[model samples]
Target: MITVTSRSELTQSDSAPDPTAEPQDGTVLFEGRHHHSGVTFFWADTPPGSGPETHWHPYTETWAVIEGDVEISADGETLQAATGDIVTVTAGTVHRFWNTGAENLRMLCIHASPELIEHEVPQD
Candidate 1:
């Protein structure tokens, strides 16, 4: 069965990592998610000066910038992405996000596999 979800009907959740947690710099506002069919879609908002630390995932991931600007670090390089920009990270690739702008950074993230939720370890 296929279901449709509109952006307006999507619910946002206020969740932040623990202060004592290893990755404690950012907040995640998951707009919505669909777990079936191995696909998960959600939106994440990070306030200025806060974003995800260097990390990776076990599944392919794509992120589309919705607002503000973000700095993406991947494969030993960094790229600045603005609104309307899209970025993709393959499975096992190291990546991270940084809210480099004054306003909040909003992005739409889609994961290819809902079952793969573990973060990848750095290859150093």
Candidate 2:
């Protein structure tokens, strides 16, 4: 089976409540479950200086930058990514992302397992 979805369709769907507001510093535009592959697509928007703290997950992830720029850090290394760039994070690797650019950063993140949801950072 094949399913097609667009940004416009997601914006208008009542079932997919706004995941954006749930995040403190940024917005999660959309997230969908893929039954066949047991994967999920999470789309989000991050304003400058907004991003999650370092954390690790059991599932692999791939993030594609759709707009603006972001600073991606993993395993003590950091790199800047612009539009059209993609970053991959293997399972169990520590990673984080920050939007340092002036405009809002848009990204599409894909996760290999639905069980890998999200893990929050602990405040020290």
Candidate 3:
């Protein structure tokens, strides 16, 4: 099956900048179940120091960095990724990322689930 969803139709954001909030630039999330798909996706082009907080899902997740740089912390391990790089976090691994570049960081977040099922890491 083929499904097409535009930025206008997608307002929810799983990361820092909200595309709907700024219009020209930012991030937007496409929850799979909402669009009759089998995977949740995030198109992110947020400003420096902007990104999602620590969180996890029951399914595996991957991030493809298309531009800028990113620093990721997953399961107590720190990783760095730049343009043309891809990183994956296994299921149930607590992870978060930050835009570690001077410019906006663009990336694609893909979740291996039909719905966006996320869980927060407990705070101290």
Candidate 4:
């Protein structure tokens, strides 16, 4: 059978990348296990010069750029991606991204795991 999750339901029960971090302007997280799925979704309209720090996952993660541009740093290399681009980082790879465009960087972060499992690297 097919199921549907309304937009209101998503807003009512979404998670942030950092539980301790303050609410951001346009960030949303959808943990799919709550809906019987095997993946997690993290979407954001991150403004320029802003982004998450380095992080790693036990499972592969992918990012589909719906709008704007981004500079992704993965495994010691920097990759540039623009609208309509899709990038994937393998499991156990250290990666992070920043909004390099003048507008908000809109993208979908798809995690392969049923739940969100991430480890953020501490900056010096």
Q: Name the candidate that leads on TM-score.
A: 4
lDDT of 1 by residue, 1-124 (tens): 7766544553333232232334242333332233235566556767898776577777789998999899888878999999999899898888888899999888877767644364645555
TM-score of 3: 0.84
- What lDDT would each prediction earn against the true structure? 0.68, 0.71, 0.82, 0.87
Q: Distance (Å) between predicted and true CA of 121, model 1?
A: 4.3
**Candidate order by lDDT, highest to lowest?**
4, 3, 2, 1
Candidate 3 structure quality by residue, lDDT tens digits, 32-110: 7777888988888879987776888999998899999999998889988999998989998999999999999999999
TM-score of each: 0.70, 0.73, 0.84, 0.91
Q: How close is candidate 2 to the true structure, as a TM-score?
A: 0.73
Clashes of 4: 0
Best by lDDT: 4
Residue range 1-124, candidate 2, lDDT tens digits: 7877655564433122333444453443344443344666657677888887777778899999999889998888999999999889998888899998999898887777743366655647
Span of 10 residues, lowest total lDDT, candidate 4 = 6-15
List candidate 1 stretches off by more than 4 Å.
Answer: 2-37, 120-124
- When summed lDDT is taken over every stretch of 10 residues in candidate 3, the lowest stretch is 14-23
Off by over 4 Å in 2: 4-21, 24-26, 29-37, 121-124
